[model samples]
Target: MDKCGSAMEFLENKNILITGATGFLAKSIFGGENLEGSTKCQETLFTVKSSKRDDSFGTQLIEKCIILIVKVIGKDLFQVLKKMWGGDFDTLISEKVCLVPGEVSLSEMGLKDSNLVAEMKNQVELIVNLAATTKFDERYDVAVGTNTLGVKHVISFAKQCPNLKLLVHISTGERGGLILETPYKLGESLNDIQGLDIATEQRVAEEKFKQLEESGASKEAITSAMKGLGLERAKMYGWPNVYVFTKAMGEMVINDVKNNLPVIIIRPTIVTRPSTVILLDMLQVTVGYATGKLTCFLAGITAIIDLVPADMVVNTIIMAMVAYELKPSNKTIYHVGSSARNSMRYIDFQRFNYQYFTKKPWINKDGDAVKVEKVTVFNNMTSFQKYMNIRYLVFLKGLEFANKVFCHSFQDKYNDMKKKINFVMRLIQLYRPYLFFNTIFDDTNAERLRMDIQKKDRETETFLLDPKEINWEDYFMNIHFPGLVKYVFK
Candidate 1:
């Protein structure tokens, strides 16, 4: 096949049903409002910076003028055109791409329109199941209802689809154990519970939920009970959390129902915008004024963070979909992560943060520059808690005591601060496990697929999905960090 033909043929006229169509990956694929609000300023800044290389003000001026024109024309018109043209802002939106609005957790995927569901069953060729509850501490009932039962619904729908070619179910990279490129039977390992079938396990979960409901527990109490149940089940099953446990159950459902059907499970690790604090700091140091040193201490400084840019993860999804189409497989599992290919050490990440902050301080909303003197990295939880207690907790407690004694009205403010501190502490506890995670996902299958595409297709066709081509430092400093600051922090 020719380059373009090979790359676009599979997706070309293939009716696809993307469950989580409003999510980040779907938005990038279909085009949506990811670049609004404070991002407009970042967009202008990026344009001006690009023009600097050519030493030309004309390019910058033109971009600014275009921005003004866009404002006058309104954002809605621009968005319509952008969506119609797709990501490149040139190619027309694939005629075959159609949005199916429904909830995955429902029986018929929450499809109110029976005709639409029938049409999907008749016409849809590929079903990309990306809908799932991603919360780490989600309640057991909600997690299983959405993540586990949701998969069963999708599979039932897929089974009805006469032309169904592939079912791409998005899973997690962390399966609470060493993950291999090949698919392994559940409970095959020593740590896993033996002979715990999905049907029996699901029944047990439902029975427990029913008992809780029958007990006439308060809503909050029921929720807490469910959460506790999920944690207990996960621990018993050798899974990390309710989210992963339910997701694994979802995969098992697919395995059971998807007889003789082509299916691929993609397990993606921490998907986040790259940290750009260092790059922004560098820019400030080089272009703006600096202030005196200020010290900042951070927890999880020596932890290892396995993260892949959201765009990269999306790219892998699309490419994997296409690759599966080209080479039909009964079952294939791909670990879409950067750990094996391009790992970033937490200590080094912190170092970059320190370097950036020390050189150029962050500007607050009030236009005051915050200086950075030094940063202390806490690898151990004990050290982190000690620092927090000495630096913040003790001081805050003193303020609270004074407010209670002298200024009773001001006590509310102190209470609010304490609540905020408690919130932060809870978040720290929630994410602490991931910060020190040591598993490296085996990506042999994914890498092989990339190589196959590289050999068969032109560089332009495969460049975006090529994981080996990523430069960790460059990507973090340029694209990831800048994007995070502009879109998220803003």
Candidate 2:
């Protein structure tokens, strides 16, 4: 990703240190905006700085440009200049955004170079930490260490950073923890602090894992032991799965100890493609890739992929930070989700998938587009055979024969494919409780944050990347999305 003028402008004046710079939302919010407001329906906020379509003039969120424009273009040259300066579009944001080399696993954020982390800690005003093991089946050790313990370290470290005004922690909405209301207050501490007293939970897990490490257990045995621990520990957590359960713990830890730090928690819903910035499409997130999406590629079928653009998540994070400045003392939970303002259902997503992927695929596999026929869901996984089995078997058999003709065992290949498909389906169903299950998010706080952005009298700069201020359908269908088929597979 090459740097541009707008990227430079957005980073001006602000010394921000972020943990996860490579993730989708982290990249989108810090990167350039779509300028035309990107493709999200939720009422969120993000800062966007862009160079002109050509290189003639530069463009940014708004306020930054107002000052320079006043010098040359003069006040009220166009509209009520003072009132519009904060929301001006011809601004630069390059100075505010800065990427730091930081990771959560180590004591000092894996930064062995104390001088560097110290320098960053000293000069940085806002410390944004979003890095975590978001993988659903992630091991208890990995998640707890990076997500839970790591947060403790950040709070402790941020306490030392004299310039640190606010420490914005990014979280997931699915960390719904037995709460029934919108303005949910902080809850009980996630007792998994020491990893489930776990070794004690299942003597077998402890003995097995220890033996494996002590004797250098075989890879397969270690893998099986790890799996056993995950299953046992997950059942103990009481939530739907480990991903949310662990994140909830991380949040609790952050809330309990973060007393004096002007902090806020921003929890985003199922995050997806960029809501604004566009990179060369390097790769898709593993969680997104393994389940709903890969199913379509294997069968060329259409199914709704329900996700909020990464851009929206990042924008919401920045907005939450700005909101911190106005009400610096409040320690509240702000949800960056799509429960109310803008939500399209899974069935709607399924409909779109069926219509588009089948007819106008990006690759044209057979020199012409290949469309998929409609599919029906079953209450029984075993029933795929009696109904669609024969059809799928036919394709499998053909592929097997071709592989054998080329001197390979197509049977083994088909067997592996079948196994992987079945595994993905099981995990998909496990997560279905969140995706298929109907859960409403009340983002009244998110709405109030937007009000702050829209106010002409507000001193904070506007990014124009407001979610409620744009057309969702056009951006999602035309500019942002589609890469799921065109680029992810490519």
lDDT of each: 0.62, 0.53
The global Cα lDDT (0 to 1) of model 1 is 0.62
Error of model 2, residue 77, in angstroms: 34
Clashes of each: 4, 24
Winner by lDDT = 1
Cα-based lDDT at residue 149, candidate 1: 87
In candidate 2, stretches whose alpha carbon ends up further than 4 angstroms from where it belongs are: 1-12, 34-102, 175-211, 276-306, 329-331, 379-418, 456-473
Worst 10 residues of 1 by lDDT: 40-49
